[model samples]
Target: MPYLLTGAQGQAGRRLLSYVVSLPLPNTDAQLLAAVLAIRAARGGVGNVTGTDLSTLRLEDARAAAAALRGLGWQIDGVLFDGDPTAAVAVTIPDLARETGHPLPVGEKLRSRVSGWVARTLTAKPVKKLPPAARLAGLFLAAHGTCDSAGQIPADLPEACRAALPDLLAKGFLAELSQDRYRLDEAVRHLSGVRPPTGGQATRPGAVPSSWPQFNADAWARWKSEATPALRRHVEAVEHCALCALPVDRVAQAFMVAPRPMVIAKATMGAYGKWKGLHPDRGSLAAEFTVAFRAEHGHGPSYYQLTSGLGWGLDRSLGAYVVTRLVKNEWLVTTGAVPWTLRPGPAAQAQGIALPKARTEAPGDVPAAV
Candidate 1:
């Protein structure tokens, strides 16, 4: 029977290959090999099969590879092997394709964000003023009063995450769980609380996270320290700008998913986001826009991002403030910068400014006003 093995490393896997190659008589353990290999695949990614251990994988594209393997008659095993104290290899199997084949498979390794919305809201809905992340952050300020939890989110995150907890709770953006874990609610997504970044931040734990890089401890910590409170202020401090009916400018800014905002460029174009200019009434008319479609439509729409276009160098007028909607609830793309440092209120105020007005859908499309 086939028996799968996994986690056996470089030299060790080669050694095992040698042993199996030299075995004069065939000893079948295909069942065992297949089970172990299957488990390893489920937990990890696609891997290279060599002797009795699995090594190097690209799990991102698993389905196609699985089909390939099934055609080869390999089942999986649920066992593991250790080459030594700090090293080891993994394995999988079904049965030998050939009773007598020379050598074994070698190893091959490989590896391998948001939006604009509003205006064409589809529905001629009445727009209401709302505070964005700034207000959310401000509420945090009111409760905490100061940036006490600087330097990092407490090592005991359950306790420290609380520092920014109140703001989320108040906004109804986050839900507290009976299991003691916290989760962002649908409302929490695209919240002004999240800050899109442009990379260059520390990439380690305890260092500031970069908007562009994947989320890490250091970046997350920096946000927990620097921006949590300010973000609160940014969100809460809003009043009016008829042109941009949202309560605050903070609400006007849509985050450009930080992790990888560029992918949407080729994927989604011609998507209109918010528009605006300096207006009377409020010093700056900034409003938030929504870009939503029925998820029931089968394949959901991808949010086109427009954040990086707004920075210092790449600050093409169209690129900067012109962002698209991101609906998938990507945390790193949205909030990578928020935990680190909030751009002071005055500064943030000037940032996400835009025009705001009710969407003009067809007459019949109008919903009964409350």
Candidate 2:
């Protein structure tokens, strides 16, 4: 059987040729006598390699090559070897000829039959809307037979083209399976004149045949090791509430998807309005509470009121812990000894907390207490 190399001028092709040549073969080895085919019409000093420079060689060209070989009284086999790891595809020569079932083209035909297929595909209605770059990328992937039936792009696609996957998927040009992997839909493939290899089997893309890369666990561990510290520091710095010196995880758990502000009725704003008007200047949770309490009851929130406002299911001890932090930070202070009425401190005022207008009535059929 003879071997055909499609990307003969490419790196993979060069590496494959070098590797094949490096193999120790005895002079009488029958396998070493098998032919190596190239498309360029020159031996280029390579004794075992022969080719034709038909860049647009199609199925008909293959037949013509077969016929020409027969005319020379030589036997030709259809086996073609593609060296690209991601695009290694096997084709049954007779099956390809039978499936395509077209007469061979003759002299003076400048464009090969495959070029016509590509032209028809590009002008097809479904692919006509694709941007030029995306269309080119999609067509290349399809033609290579690397993309799966589900439209998943090979993991090894160039990074720049990878970014276009979402748009391609959205427009029905590709389907994403996971990170950096996409497939072209069947319609797109059919319209683009791209066909799966004969017998419908292929080696896994991005892997050497019969072997896989190292375990993903190592990569995951490395990423986590690097990312954890940076994430912890950012969470601590960004969410360190003055009133609650809770741990980073705790704050994230409570507020990451926290619910919207509670809707309280307006009729309940009587008891809190009798105290002196106070405005909070800080932008912390404690300052927000102080401002809200002052607007509702003319004073900062007491421990119980603050605890209820938390709605975080913390017990009084935890609530007291928060209060202690606020007091230590000089954001809040007790104004009355009997009931322990809370009031904003200089720090809270300096943070720009301000009083809100008193509401006489509630909106949306609810009393505004908060």
Candidate 3:
């Protein structure tokens, strides 16, 4: 499992990732890799401590990345947010783990925050009178503060949640501060268990709190007059650790604790040695073929004469597997079938190759121009 740090280019996000990665964990679990995956679109950086950089992914690409992890039976430990958390909480790492019965990493650093979010969410009252979307909007406002100083909704908020902002503020979870802007009340903030930085300083006692610059006098009066705020559920619990309830195996896997290399080497030789031969200076057989095919024929080689052409005595399945890998890596593109044809894909084009006509594409099937 990996920890995702969002707004990763920001100072807070970078600091949090740095701190989280430095914490020590038990060295016998492979469930957690001791690296952090940081994401940001502006610079298109996604990398882990291992120094593997998958560059320039769109923000929406994070979902695909997470899904790929899940397919491998790994789950995200948590997401450290350095941006608006309104949408972040909806896909909260803890919540996703709980929903899917996957293990969630619970480092001492994040346990308190996770528990707090769980407690707050489980106890939050729904605005029964409002539609479902509006109710969630109300909940988000109550949990996170109103829009930022510019009165703009957090860019990270889901569209549906953004649509509910107007109705939520009408009820005072958010008090109108200025034209199209708002401020969350102390009551809502308290229930959410989040305190904004006071005076642009960390949330410390004695720090002056940020004031609502355009607080509506009538709205404040109406808010104070309400008999019970009536907006939140008056519920509380002992807040036992959510991780404690898991079975022993599940609990053991919760934190992305990684095993030492020696211990891993003992478990399975191949698993530990998988990365031993990946020399950056050399290419694999598939890569060599991809390059050769693109240079010679301006496309991927067909498996029709795999044994002789590949010089590896590969059978159809093995040959197909190799081709599949090339396709997956974007080295080859299948143009058509009948005899099956392949063309140089984006990876080849990226290499500055000016593709020419390939005799291998079948004489009649060949296009007028290369």
Per-candidate local distance difference test: 0.24, 0.35, 0.33
lDDT, model 3, position 362: 36
Please give the RMSD to the true structure for each candidate, in Å.
Answer: 24.1, 30.7, 26.7
Best by lDDT: 2
On residues 1-370, what C-alpha lDDT tens digit does candidate 1 reach at each position? 1111111111112222232223331121221123224323321233234422332221222333344444455442223222332233333343322111212211211000000111111011111112222222222222111111112111222222344455445555444422334444433222221221113221111122223334354644454356334343322332121111221212222222343344445312332222222111111111111110111111111121112111101233333223222212111122233211111123112343211222444453321110
- Candidate number achieving the greatest TM-score relative to the actual structure: 3
lDDT of 2 by residue, 1-370 (tens): 1111111011122222222233332211111121122111111111122122111222223444444443433344333222332332221222112111111111111112233334444455555565544544454455433223443444444444456556667776665445745565655544322222323222211111222233254553354356334333333432332222233333333223333443333432332232112212111445545554343233344564454442323344444555655766777765323122455555655655434443444233211122
> lDDT score, residue 263, model 2?
36
Clashes of each: 86, 19, 2
TM-score of each model, in listed order:
0.17, 0.23, 0.26
* Window of ten residues with lowest summed lDDT in model 2: 99-108
Instruction: Give candidate 2's error at residue 72 in angstroms.
Output: 38
Q: How good is model 3 by TM-score?
A: 0.26
